[model samples]
Target: MHWLTLHTSVPMGQQTYETSIQQAVRDLAEPGWDFRASSVGSGRSAATLRIPQRVLDDRRGARLVGAATGLRHDLVHRFDLRVPPARGPHVLTMHDLPPMRFPDEGRLPAWCTEPLPSDVEVICPSDFAASEVTELVGARRVTVIPYGVRPSFRQPAPSSPEDQRALGVSRPFFVHAAGVTRRKNLEGLAEAWAIAAPELPDHELVLLGPPHGRREELFGHLPRVVLAGKVDLDAVGKVMAAAEAVVVPSTYEGFGLPTLEGMAVGTPVVAVDRGATPEVARGNALMTEPDGPSIAEALLAVGRHEIDRDDLVRRGLARAATFAWDTAARAHLDVYRKVTG
Candidate 1:
């Protein structure tokens, strides 16, 4: 079966959605399955113009393109640019309904909350995300396929001072790898650090993604908070490996990729029990309430080595082993076959 996957041309810095798509494309490219990929925008700044070009391409012939990422109205109003009679089967991957849930974020248009096209099949990264998509889009056919951790995440490395210095981070630090958005709860994490600071005297909180939306107001005054800015995926894996513990205090997440990444490196994860955080952590990492004091206590416990760190690491390694790109690709291939057959 020949397949084409549509993707965003813009570099999705530190976002695992792009990583998942790229990994899936690589794994699914095998004999009998002729897989190809195209971006919505070419390398130019006027990439949005490519949407119409895609429509023109569709007019040429029937081609099956996997809408491998979420749709934005500014990019394309419909799932496929092709009109009826010319349109072929196209699959969409809906990571989550965050825009619908948090409209104030302005990440998505109001019309995005409307029901999806009946002809489009959906792939969700987690059951939590699938439920959200089904409720928001009224999608009838939804498949749950979780993302995989890269091999770099599994390679063990010491939390050496040299590595920390290379990343401009100090030793005895807890890492939060998500972007500094409201949904990521950086403010709450800062508050938690303040609450836990009396106990965690030696540890600093290292944030490893780009800042957004009044991040200064949220984290500027936090004494121990270090904004490391954006880093590549390899650097992210190294940072995760070299941390005292990985904290994910997100109010919502589609799949919580960092939780697995932290666990894969044998680092304990302290994530709030919200959205898919608990599901992704899977009783391997430390779970906390979505508040300052509660999360503070959890962080303190990890910092003091109050929990059985060795056992936690062992469980995390085992849990992380279960999520692999090959596994996700097989599931996606199954969905592709079902849709195209």
Candidate 2:
């Protein structure tokens, strides 16, 4: 079957969704399958079917593509939740329902609230997300194919002094690589930092991701908290490698990539028990409730050297090794086959 990936979304710098599609395509093509890609505008290739961004942006564009090129393509797959109408079968990857869960988050478009087409095949990165799709979108079929941590995170080079200087890493700190969104439970993290700040006086809490306007309003009082806005994944891997611990305080996640990335980098991770985190953590991370006190307790445990850090890191590495892009690619191929056949 000839599968084409429709990449219509612009790169907004939160690399998770974009990175997943890019990595998947790279691996999918690695096996020399008839994998093709279509974007807003790009040079034509044997494997690339160029589609204008404006043409795809139109409400009728998806169906028009099917009518125009249906003979050439067997299936279409979208990486994000924006599943426009198509004449033939297509797959949509609903990363999470943040727009539905936190209606005011503004991270996703309002169209996310609309129920997905019943005919469209849905793909989720985790079972937790699949449940949401089943309940909210009323999707009859949902496939859970977990994401893989990039190889850079798995065998990360140590954070050098220059890398530290670039990301404003001045001291030993706990890193939260996920952005400060409502679902991220920044309020809980702030309160938790307040509780744990006294315990680890020498350590700082590093917040990474794009800088939001409400950041200082929420975290300014905490002198120990540093807002290290938006570092690339390579820098994130290095920082995670050198951190005392990686923190994931989000109340919800689709796949919780950071949890797996932290583990891949061989760092002890502290994540909330809610959403897909526990599923991703898999007993490799110190799980805590999604509250200030619970997160604080976990933070204190890590800071005070109470838990078996070596054992935690060892287990994390072993567990993270299982989620390979090759595996994800094979699973995706299976989905494409089943969908088109």
Candidate 3:
């Protein structure tokens, strides 16, 4: 079967989407599928473009997809319903409904909010996200496909103290790997770290990924918080391995990837009981409320090793084993076959 992968022209720093696309491409290619890919915005060639350049790239992408024909299915990893459906079945992967949940973040364009074309099937990473899309867009065809943790995350390697030192992270730290977005609850994390730092001496809170607007100002005052900025994937694995626990305090998530990654690496995770986090965590993580005090208590408990860390690690590894990229790829192929049939 032939497949056309439609990706958004996200900048290089948007690692999550990029990684998802890469994983999809790699696994799909392995099955000997006739696959082709095109980006909907400023592709790699024009990645550094400003707004006007991006508009031109979007137009170019639209022209390419619109003119293309004979593809068995077009899988859109980025949601842009404005792009008309292809000649064949169109599959859209909806990551989240952040705009609807957090209107203050920004209003979604009419195209995003409006019902998609009848031929377009939606793929949600979790049932939580699938329900939201169904309710908001009244979508009739939606499938749940959870993401797989990278093999590197599951590698059984000893903690890299040298790598941790290079990143300026000490041992026994809690890592927060998501971007500093409003949805990530960075403010709550900072507050929780401040409250918990006193109780757990020598324990630091490591913040990974790029800083969002005003994030530096908000988290700067917290001495125990270490803003490691953006690091390579190898660095991420190393840091995760050495961490006492990985904290995911997001109020919302389509699928909590970092939580899974931590679990894969045998690190305990403390995540909030919101959205798909509880579903993805699956009794593997220490569930907490989305408030500062609750997160603080959880962090303290984890740092003090009050909980059975060994048991948590064992359960987390087993849970992580259930998610595989090949499995997700097969599921996608099944969806494609079902849609085309």
Question: lDDT-based ranking, best first?
Answer: 2, 3, 1
- Which scores higher on TM-score, 1 or 2? 2
What's the C-alpha lDDT at position 246 in model 3? 87
For model 2, the superposed segments whose C-alpha errors exceed 4 Å read 10-33, 40-71, 107-118
* Candidate 2 local Cα displacement, residue 55, angstroms: 9.6
Q: After superposition, how far is residue 77 of candidate 2 from its true place, in Å?
A: 0.6
Better candidate by lDDT, 2 or 3: 2
Location of the lowest summed lDDT over 10 successive residues in candidate 1:
72-81
Q: lDDT for each of the candidates?
A: 0.70, 0.77, 0.73
**Candidate 2 colliding pairs:** none
lDDT of 3: 0.73
TM-scores of all candidate predictions against the true structure: 0.84, 0.87, 0.86
Each model's Cα RMSD: 5.5, 4.0, 3.6
Which pairs of residues collide in candidate 1? none
Regions of candidate 3 where Cα sits further than 4 Å from its true position: 10-32, 42-84, 103-107, 156-159, 211-213
